[model samples]
Target: MPLGVVIRRQPGVTRWAKWVWRAVAVLPGAASADWQELRREGEAVEYHAATLPLTVYRSETEAYRIVLAAESPSVFVVLHPSEEASPDRPYVVHSVTVSAHEAQQALDSGEELVEPVPMPPPLYAWLADFVDRHHADETFMKRKRGPAVEMQSEDGKGDARIRQAADVYRSPASRRKGELH
Candidate 1:
C-alpha cells in the first residue's frame, strides 16, 4: 500500500489574503485513500505524496517570511515512475517531503514529476515537532576574497624569449578573410 500523509488546513485571514495557513494535523500513517490528486499528464500522475511544512532558516530573508506569512503553508510532493506495468506511461510519485529544495532536485533530474501544494493541516502538532527538530536561525556569511595572483613573472615581466617568430602582427589584408576564419 502506498503511504500517505493527511494534511488539514485551517481557515483564517492574513494581512496578505483572505486566508491564513495553519498546519493543524499530520497523519503519517495515512492510507492511499487519504491523499488528494493535484495533477496528471499522460501516463504520469502526481499525488499529495506527503505533508512537509517548509521552513527558511536565515534571518535576512524577512521579505521571504512576509511572503510566506501572507500565504498558506505548503508541502513538496515528489513523483517517481511507477513500478507497475503501464501500456503507455511510465511513472508516478508516491513520496513527499517538506523540503522544496529536495523536491526541486528530484524534478531537475528530469525523471519524475514534482509539485508544491498548499497543505491542509493535521499538521499543527506535527508542525511543532517538525520545527523543534529542524528549526535553525542561521546567520549569513560573506565570502572572503582569495589572494590575488601576479599575472607575470616575479620580476614583473614575461620571461619567454621568441627568437624565431615572424611578424604575426602584420596587416590582415594579405590573408583572405575566409582563410583567416
Candidate 2:
C-alpha cells in the first residue's frame, strides 16, 4: 500500500528547534541499513531516511506531532506491503513504538525488516525543489575577498590637516591669532 509520511511541527518550537527536530527525525534507527546505503549517494549525509513506514503529521490540538509506530519506543521501522497489493485496502499489521536498544536487539536476532516506499510525484518534486534551493552551490562556496584600495591623506607628516586646509582656504581677516582659521 502507498503510505503518506508527514512530519508535523511541534508546539513551543522555535525555528531553530524545528530544524533540530527535523534533523533528528531523519536519522536512521539502530537497525536500519537503508539509511546507510542511501548515504552513499550524492551529498547523502544531509538526507535522513524514516526507519518506519510511519507518517508524522501535526495535530490540531498541538500535541504529539511526531508520531510513528515501531516495535520499540526509540526505533521506527518501515513496513512495505507486497507490490501487487492495492493501496486502498487495509492490511493487518502491528504498529507499535519501541526503544532503540530493543530495535537493535530485534535486528541482531535476524528479525529486522524494511520495505522501501516509492517516492510520490509531489514529494519528489518538492524534494527536488528543496534541494535546489537549499543546497550550497560549489561556485559560491569558495570565499573570495574584494580588492582593497589605499586612502590618500589630505595632509603631509606633522601637518594639521584641518588647520592647514582652513588657513589655505579661509580669508585673511577671518583667521584667528595663534589659531588656524
Candidate 3:
C-alpha cells in the first residue's frame, strides 16, 4: 500500500510531552505505534500514526487548539478546543481537508500535493530540506566484483620440502651419498 507521509510541527510542543498525552489517551487493545521524533530548525517534532493515516499537531496556545491535515494531500484542518474531553481530544483549531481525487488531479497535472497552511515557513522549509538530506545515496552502491575464495588442505597430503645436499653433508651421509642414512 502506498502510504502518505505528512510532516507537521506543533510550535512550543515537545515530542515527549505529546507521547505522555497519547499514552494516557490510548487504552489497552488499541493498535498504535510509538511516535517518531524528527528535528527541524533545531526544534523537535513528533509524529504519531492515526487510524485515518493522518498527522496531528497541538497548538502552542493554552487553548489546546490543533492542526490536522493529510501530509500528502492538499487538504488540512485547524480545529478549535472543545469544552468536553472524550475518547478523542477535540482541541482542533483548524482543519484542512484535501480529497484523494484532488490529490490525484494535482499529481496528474504535475503539481505539488503538499500545500502549506499558516504554519511557520521555516519549519516547512526545514522539513523539505530534512527529507532531501535523508534520501538514500545510491551512487555509492556498486555490483560485487568477485566471489570469496575457500582454502582447504588435500585429503592426507601436507606441505613438505627436501633437505638440501650441502645442509646434509655430514661425514657418514657424505660417504654414502646415494645410500640411505
The Cα local distance difference test for each model comes to 0.46, 0.32, 0.33
**Model 3 lDDT tens row, 1-181:** 1122223444435764541221111111224333333333444343432212333222211111112133321233323334674323423322222233333444465423334333334433433344344434345667787876645423323234545443342444234447554
Task: Give the number of the best model, judged by TM-score.
Answer: 1
Question: Considering TM-score, which of the candidate structures 1 and 3 is the better prediction for this target?
Answer: 1
Cα RMSD (Å) between model 2 and the true structure? 20.9
Best by lDDT: 1
Q: Which ten residues in a row are the worst by lDDT in model 2?
A: 58-67
TM-score for each candidate, following the candidate numbering: 0.43, 0.20, 0.21
The deviation in Å at residue 145 for candidate 2 is 27
Better of 1 and 2 by lDDT: 1
Tens digits of per-residue lDDT, candidate 1, 1-181, equal: 1235433332335665433222223344455452465445453344443543234454324333332343666555555655874522233445655544566578889976665556545543454444555546667999999888754334312335533223344334444444432
Off by over 4 Å in 2: 1-77, 80-111, 137-181
Give one digit per residue, the lDDT tens place, for model 2 in 30-91: 34322233232232232323334433222211111111222211323433333555432112
